[model samples]
Target: MLEDKKDGWKAAIALAPAMIFLVVFMFFPLVNTTIMSFMEGFQFRANAGIFAISHRYQGIGFQEYINVLRDPIFLTALKNTMVMVVISVPISVILGLLVSVCLNNIKRLQNIFQTIFFLPYVTNTIALGMVFKVMFSTNNGLINLIVETFGGDKIAWLTDATTKGYWSALFVITCYTVWSGLAFKILVFLSGLQSIDKQYYEAARIDGASRARVFWKITVPLLSPMIAYITITSFIGAFKAYESVIAVFGRGSYIFGPAGDTNMWITVVGYVYKLLPSLMTPGNLSKASAGSVILLLIILAFTGIQLYVSKKRVHY
Candidate 1:
């Protein structure tokens, strides 16, 4: 009993630093944001003596939430984010799985191929974005160069001149999101594939199972756990997408394709980021906090649904 108790104390001591860090950075901020979200007629004042800004609400109600939901920019962000989630997640997962399987089958240069596919993940997002920007540049970009070589007109992919509403810019953004995320997903699936016992594959092959049948029955079922995990994380990440848009369209106002509203491609987190610089406006902090809270709830709800559904489908 004494030894066990002493070991328990040591374990607690080992975990203390992480627990404290989480409380200070994650837990406290979440709690504070939740409180701020409810503030109505919120006021912010700076006290030089304390070197801190103080804030309070005159009447706490649903005003912050109401304001966020009523904003057209927020609505547009919500739409783009939803489209991103719906489109990007599955495509990334499927492509990653396919590439992983192909890489696993190759007997030669497999490590080199795996590294090539994973290079984007290890590279900086801003750098990759710049490379992609050059590739898609309107005047002399690689994409335009190819198009012109084939007698097609040059198209401005990121600017407001694109005639396809938000589709052109959105296409560029979605492709980046999918391509950038592929490396991690491919790595995960490859790890899962390697962990599976060879006996299963051998048995399937001896039984003369077709490639399609073997894949769906053995590989897919074995990988369902990884797939579920990736899907959940991808959905959450897609909802919080901000930097990719910034990377592709830049900080320029009215750059979201044909509609040309700066807010057109603004994501939920992007909206929150834009509002955070202004502390002088009444309830401004509350509005940003409310937006953050809504995004949290959206992520939680989607995660919950995925978890529930995965219980039925996920093999492990």
Candidate 2:
């Protein structure tokens, strides 16, 4: 009994550091942020040119939520986030699945191709965003240079919303997102593909099943579990896809747009960044906190719906 107690304590001691780290770096900060969202204004502010501190909780009503909903910027951010979720998730998953299957069929250089596909995932986002910004620049960008070299006019990739140039920027952003996101999905699909019984495919082939028919009838159903996982994760990732965009695009001038032409393309994280600066100001702090809470709830609702739907669809 004493030995068992000592072993348990040793195990707990092994876990203690991680537990402490989580509490300090994650849980405590999360709790503080949540509580801060409920409180009014900043923790410290200047009143009549004198420094002051207020700890009072405020803005606890429908009005807080109404205020958030009423803001056009917030609405645009929400719409943009949803659009990103819609666009990026499907494309990335499909592309990842395709790449995974292709890799599965390849006998040699499989690792090389898979590594190439995954390279972008490990590359620094800030560096990649900077590189992409230059490549997609309106003038003298490599993309425009290529187009012009082929006797095409030098097209504006950014800062021109007219004639769908704004969409060009969006496409550029989405392309990189898809590129960066594919690695994880590919890994997932590969794992799923590997786990599937080889005898199943052999059995289908002996039954005169074509490749497409076999894939649809055999591979896809078995891949559902990983597909479901990718779906949920991709949905969540859409909310976070703004990091690269923000790095490439300047802050808040075009702030998710080519001058109000393409409104509401910002992700939820971008919206939070918009409010983050208000943390130092007591007046705006509460409202910002409210915004934070709303964003959290929105994300929670989206993920919950996805999980419930996927659970219903997943066949054991």
Candidate 3:
């Protein structure tokens, strides 16, 4: 018992630094944010290199959450984020699976192909967004040039607000998101595919299984765990998309409609970012915190659902 106690003490000592870091950084912030979410009109005061809530406007209620849910801008951001998550995640997963399967089959120059595909994953997101913006520019973009070469009129790929009454910007953003997210999914799927038993494929081949059947029956079921993981993570990432919007459309840029009214291509994170400045005052701090809490809950709920579904569907 004394030896076990000594070992336990050593283990605790070893973990002390990491535990302190998490408490100071992650846990504290999460707790503070949750507390702020329930508060209204709370102000922050800085003192001696630390910040504390001022008691001037302490309101403990759900009004902030109600306001967040009712605010049109927040609602729009929620809709856009949902649309992005729904559209981009499935497309990315499908493309990743297909490409990974192809890559798995190609033995010659496999490393080179893997490197080329993974380049996007390592590339700077802002730089890639800039490149995409340039390519989709309405005035002198490569896409417009190609269209002009084919005797077609220039199309406003990024700047278009309403084609008939729908937000065209959503489509552009969705496409960009799917393209950007492909590399990571492909890498994970390829790794999972390689780890799968080759004997399964051999058995399928001996049974005269067609390529499609073999993939559906053997590869997909075996790859279900990776698929579930990728899907959950991709969905969360898509829901929090903000950088691409900032890169393609400058910060605070808006999509102008035919009636001259404007709509910002803001995601949930973007909405929170916009609201963060208001936290300096007693006006919107609680509201911003409420939005953040909503976002956190959404991510948690989705993750839980994915986990539950995976338990039923995933094989090992």
Best candidate, TM-score-wise? 1
Off by over 4 Å in 3: 48-55, 163-167, 251-262, 278-283
lDDT of 3 at 11: 100
Model 3 score (lDDT): 0.79
lDDT of each: 0.84, 0.74, 0.79
81-172: candidate 2 lDDT, tens digit per residue: 77777888899999999899999989899999989988887888877777888888878789988998899987776667664765676788
The residue ranges of model 1 lying beyond 4 angstroms of the native Cα positions read: 47-54, 161-165, 252-259, 278-283
Candidate 1 residue pairs in clash (backbone atoms < 3 Å)? none
Q: Could you arrange the candidates by TM-score from highest to lowest?
A: 1, 3, 2
Clashing pairs for model 3 are: none
Q: Report model 3's TM-score to 2 decimal places.
A: 0.90
Tens-place lDDT per residue, model 1, 132-174, is 8788878889998999999999887876543463777888888
* Selected candidate, larger lDDT, 1 vs 2: 1
What are the models' TM-scores? 0.92, 0.84, 0.90
Predictions ranked by lDDT, top down? 1, 3, 2
Please tell me which model should have the higher TM-score, number 1 or number 2: 1
Q: How many backbone clashes does candidate 1 have?
A: 0
The 10-residue segment of model 3 with minimum total lDDT is 252-261
Q: How many clashing pairs per prediction, in order?
A: 0, 5, 0
> What C-alpha lDDT, on a 0 to 100 scale, does residue 103 get in candidate 1?
94
